[model samples]
Target chain A: MAPFAGYDMPISYPTGAVEEHNICRRGVGLFDIDHMGQLIVSGPDADAFVSHTVSGAVLDMKDGDARYSLLLDDKGLVLDDLFVYRLPGRWWIVVNASNLETDVEWFTLRAREWKGTVKVEDVSEATYMIAVQGPRALELLDLMGTPKASSCPRFTSGEIVIQGTKNLFGRTGYTGEDGGELFFPAQDALGLWEGFIKAGETHGIEVKAIGLAARDSLRFEAGMPLHGHEISPSINALEAGFKWACDFSKPDFVGKKALEAIAAAGVSRKLVGIEITGGVPREGYDVVSPSGEKIGTCVAGMFCPTTKKYAANAFVEPQFARPGTEVAVMAHGKPKSGVVVKRPLYLPAYRR
Target chain B: MKIDSAARYQASHEFARKDGTVFVIGISDHAQEALGDIVFVELPEVGKTFAKGQSFGVVESVKAASDLYMPISGTVTAVNDALGGDPALVNRDCYGLGWIAKVEATKAGEFEGLLDAAAYEKEAGKD
Candidate 1:
């Protein structure tokens, strides 16, 4: 276990990361991601308040709809990435654990700016998040879960009544799998954990608890962005190639002015996937040209079990972001030959 | 937590056991267990020489890369070539088939200076 965002979390179970990763890819796997934070946004003028905070256009989302959006600072750089959910009475946002307090305070300040009509509550302390991912995730969940889990539309929040307790879940995950991120009370953490395990057993599937190590590798291979890795305070959404997250048509949002100006001027750097051989590439490693001239920096790399290649995500000059472009990654003080490729190296079941 | 009683261990976790004129070198079972799944192993070429406690090669797991230290001054005699294709052997049989390399010891006295099974076991527990 290691300390992350003030929480001591498991890097992997005794079964190891490689096995845990493979299990999530093929069968069913569970991740105790309670370290993530949740918040409820509501009250009069909430639409205007949320619209002013996030880069995404959240007003049009129907109830139960969820959107992956960016929380940007006025300077047009990402402050955090969040999942904004449209509940019946309020907007439920899931933010990164490391930025929980800052995000809550940001919302509180923004609400105050609106004359205190908007309400922002920090519900993270009472929440628990479990990611159930793989091809058979919903099936495994439906065995004992209520409210017909599969009926939960993909990419949206759905309700599940567990022993009369209401839980919110979304058919979404960082790993490239057909699964849901289950959100419920922290007090029911044990019951939900054991329920999933028992359900997995009933289906003849081993529901292993995945750790942070495999969680990172799976996200890296799926072309998903991490807080400190891909999208940080210094890295803007456009530079990270998350243009879709930024809705330029939205009127009056934080960072909208700067982001629109950048879009008009075009992004300087681009993010791309690289398959490296001879060594493993890691965060902050230089991406160099054939002559060893520094071209970019690697964000993360790992052994991609699906592709059977050592894959990495790097931000490089736009000229080298094309697929099949030859590159090299400086790994362990040595340059390892690499080539740029399209991301999401392992295709997700939902996409297929 | 299993230890091969016949081998002597370096504090860095490499184990060396004298075999005729050569000494078989591999990481301890404790080290392999801590490393989780081993994905790649880089070993020194045969005939390369190193001083005691010097880094000879690298062993990579899914998590990170770690340097393998020489327990005693020796010249590389042979490297386990099968690791090139399947490095998980290190996780499965670290002391037997997973032996990293065979070395012709140049400073034989260094082996005796290393920790015995009982002492190494006690040290491993502390970690």
Candidate 2:
């Protein structure tokens, strides 16, 4: 186990990260993602409060629907990327583990400034989240007798009962594959994990216990953004390639004016995909032009198991952001040749 | 993981075996296990020379990249070119086909400083 956001998280099983990653692509993989935070917002003013605070269209979401959104500071810099689920009567917000406390505090302080009644509760301690991802994920879920797991559409959620315990789940995941994230009480975590393992065996599916290392590689290959790596307070949503999440048509929202201005003036830098030929380019490595002049820095990089090559995402000048542009990444103190590719180095295999 | 009985070991987990005047060098089984899956290996040229304890090559796994050190000062005689295409050979068979390089030892007493299998097993056991 390795330390991740104060949790003793598994980095990989004995099969190693590569095998686990391959299993997720070919079969099924399970993850213990209890470190993520769960926040509940409810009251008379909850809808308006949520819609105004986040960059996504929150109020338009129907019950059992979820949307990817972002919270931004006053200057339009992203504070955290999150998923907002419209439950029966409350809004369920799932934020990154490291930014949980800060996000809760921000929501509480903002609630006080609003005119109507709004209550925000931090329910992270009482929640346990498990992710089942990959091509055969739904088949395993169906074999386990999880109701609605097979029929639920993407970005939708439903409640289910497993082992006589009530649980909630959403057809969402960080891996660009088909999956569902199960949420239940903390006390039932062990039973649910073992139950899934047994169910997988009964159905002849190769369901392996995945770790954070493989989780990162899988998500990286799918072109998903990590909290600290891709989306951060230093980067705005537009430059981070999340302009779609920012609803400019909304009348009033935090960072709306600034985002509109940025959209009009156009962004100077853009996040782009890079394929390195020589060595692996890790986070914070410098991206240079053909003549070896530094242009930007790599925000996230790794040896993509699916692509079988080193790839990365970096924010570079607009001219260098186009696909097929020649660039170089500094790895091990030497510049390695690469090309700027399109976002999502691999096409998503999501069952939408 | 098995430690070769005929090979000499370094504290950093490299093994050197004498065949005539040339020493076949590779990382130990314990080192390969610790690194997980081997993805890439950067080997020295066939004729490169290095001082004792100098970094001679690189071995990268999914988790990290580490510098492979020389056990003794010598001139490289041969490199296992097969590792360039399939670096996982080090993880699958670290003692035999996974041999990284063969070096012509520069001095006669260079093998005297390395530890035997029993001593290395004890040394590796502590971690």
Candidate 3:
């Protein structure tokens, strides 16, 4: 089935969504993320230019290290969430597939207006992203390539030779598990995917060829905010609980001033997790207090596989931000009980 | 998968089995397959009246939520309470134990509009 990201993505395997979630939680699941955009920001001024365009401190990052950041307009609304990596001479910016065309256009327009030099090129077609997520992901990936579990830290990546194949590897995952995501050529994807599946068989790894359906749920459980829902141009990063990504200490970056103003003014709204006691909380569900008072709105909600109950994340008035705060969700014309909880519905088992 | 001809179906993916006044209602095999895993089921309350083609409840899979539309106008007499604790039963045995609700048909000719197993297979695009 097609998904909101504008891809006719698979909902799950013929075995179904339950099996796919279970497979990834207990074993490992492979996902085809070829549709995501990969851009190379090179040239002599790549480092300085990237720092100016994004929200995070780029100069502090070392080669091969990856940091989660957001590209924002001058007004402080997020254009998109992206992963930035410091390569040898240039930088690599990986953006959401659905926003590829828009992101390229936006970045190119800014690059042209810049007083300094920065070469931004779209390299999406040349790269293919495959994510191996779940508890057994690292082990399964190691079988296909070299094992670097002990050395590689979380949110970091490196160039590794796997199964005689040279590929870019990162110790990151959307699922709340210890795993890695690899980037290689589209031609190499099918082979490496099947190879991992075969190698994972002996280790009791259930190979789930996951699609976008499970991808959304996995990211939600990991407390990772999405672009359109949680971090749109109308939404502020601080309100989306991404204040950590904004660095004022850096020389300066887009939206830094606006973020500082919001932070100082005290956030009017903030993102918080909610567990639905009465029903499945879905995206766009209205948030209300127990007495029929409107508080905020849910951006993402799902029936959590791990918890076996309904869970959601919402951007609510900051007064209701405390954990255990009682709330209500309006669904099917009925008000259901909900409560504010921790940020991530589940904790990620990053390879520390 | 192949569709079973003996199983009667509806365009909305609902399946029905009639015996005099009582008809067992649930989604078709094609639906269960298309929906992937059946995680949560919100069956209509017993003794609730619904018009034909009206939404009675919802079926939540791991990925998306599907509304369960009434195949025929009727009053809900009973629900499959077992689904409350084991919703996956819908995925495992959708036509049998996974049945949604038992209804007392409001109109006699409503059942005639539903498709037989053969017609349903074609409508579901399984053929």
Candidate 4:
């Protein structure tokens, strides 16, 4: 166990971390996303408030729809990456687990700037989140009384009534699997978790309690970025491959001018995927050219069990962004060979 | 499943058995379990001198890397090269074939501060 934000998180079970990681990839696994913070932005200026605070176009979204977005600082550096879903009469924003307090403060201060009536309320303590991911995730969920096996659009959500509890369910996940993120009343979480595990047993689905350790490795394998690692207050959204999220065409938003300049000049450094051999490539490992010239730095990395290789994502000089660009990772005080590739190291086997 | 109550331990988890000037040094069973599956072990070269608690080498497990510290001030007299290929021996036989390095203690009083097997068993039992 390791200390993370005052909680004792298990890095690996006695069985092994490698096995735990593969279990999530090949079969269904349940994750306790209860640590993540949720907030409700409501009132007359709800749409306008979210539009101004986030990089995405939340103002244009209708109820029951979700959009991927980023919370940017005044200079347009990312403070947090989030998903905001428009609910009936309110907008629900899901912020990163470790950045709950910081995100709440960021949103609260911005809500005060709205010219119209808007109230930002933190509902994280009153709600709970559970992520069920894998190829059979929907099937097991169907057995639990979730309606419809049909696929929902990538960033959309649907409300479901399960076990007499109303759950706001979204067809989204970070594990690169066919799964859903469900938010329900906090009092119903333990019962819901037990029910899922018991029902998943006979279907040959494995139930494991995923912690931050496996979460990091699985997200790395799926090419998903974490807040502090890949996106930070000092990094721009364009260089981090979040350009699609920013809509400059819309009316004025935060840091639009800086982002326009970045897009026009082209990014000097770009985030690229790299596969390493000889040793594990961890965060902050120096990326160098064959001649030993430093070219970049690893933002996140892990030993990917599916491919049986060590992989990393680095923000390298633009000259090295193309696939097949050769680079060396300085590991254990030695140079190890690696090559830049596209993200999504493990292609999902899901039918979707 | 059994622990030798007479063996002594250092805070670094290395166990030392003193017989005159020579001391047999290996990691304790608790250390092996805490490290999980050991993948590689790097040992110090023979004739290297170290004060008590000096890091002698590194042990890489599948999950993490740990540094092996000397239990007592000593001069390295022999090294265990077999561990380079089969580091799992440390998990299987930490007190026997898993012995990492042998040393001739320069400070005989250093072993006095180490915990005997009974004391270590009590320490391990607490958690």
What is chain B's TM-score across the candidates, in the order shown? 0.98, 0.96, 0.92, 0.91
> What RMSD does each model have against the real structure?
1.7, 1.7, 2.7, 4.6
Instruction: Put down candidate 2 lDDT per residue, A281-349, tens digits, no spaces.
Output: 788999999999999999988778888888889999998999999999997788989999987876677
Candidate 4 lDDT over residue span A183-293, tens digit each: 999999999888888887877777666666677778777777898888998788988988888877768677777788788888889888899765667789999998999
Model 3, B1-127: lDDT tens digits are 4454545677889877785668888998788877777777888889999998899999977657899999888999999999988888988888788989999988848878789877787788943
**What's the lDDT for residue A105 in model 2?**
99
The reply for model 4, stretches above 4 Å from the true place, is: A6-8, A13-15, A59-62, A149-153, A348-352, B1-29, B36-63, B68-127
Q: Residues B47-105, candidate 4, lDDT per residue (tens digit)? A: 99998888888776656768888998989999878876567789889888888999999
> Clash number for every model?
0, 0, 1, 0
Q: What's the C-alpha lDDT at position A281 in model 2?
A: 79
- Rate residue A311 of model 1 by lDDT: 80
Better of 1 and 2 by DockQ: 1
Task: Summarize candidate 1's per-residue lDDT along A163-274 as a digit string, tens digits.
Answer: 5557898988989988899899899999888888887887798688899998988887788899988899999888898788877777788998888888898888998999
Fnat for the candidates in order? 0.56, 0.39, 0.56, 0.00
Against the true structure, whose DockQ is highest? 1
List where candidate 3 sits over 4 angstroms from the true fold: A3-7, A113-116, A147-150, A202-204, B1-9, B19-21, B62-64, B105-114
TM-score for model 1? 0.96
Window of ten residues with lowest summed lDDT in model 2 chain A = A343-352
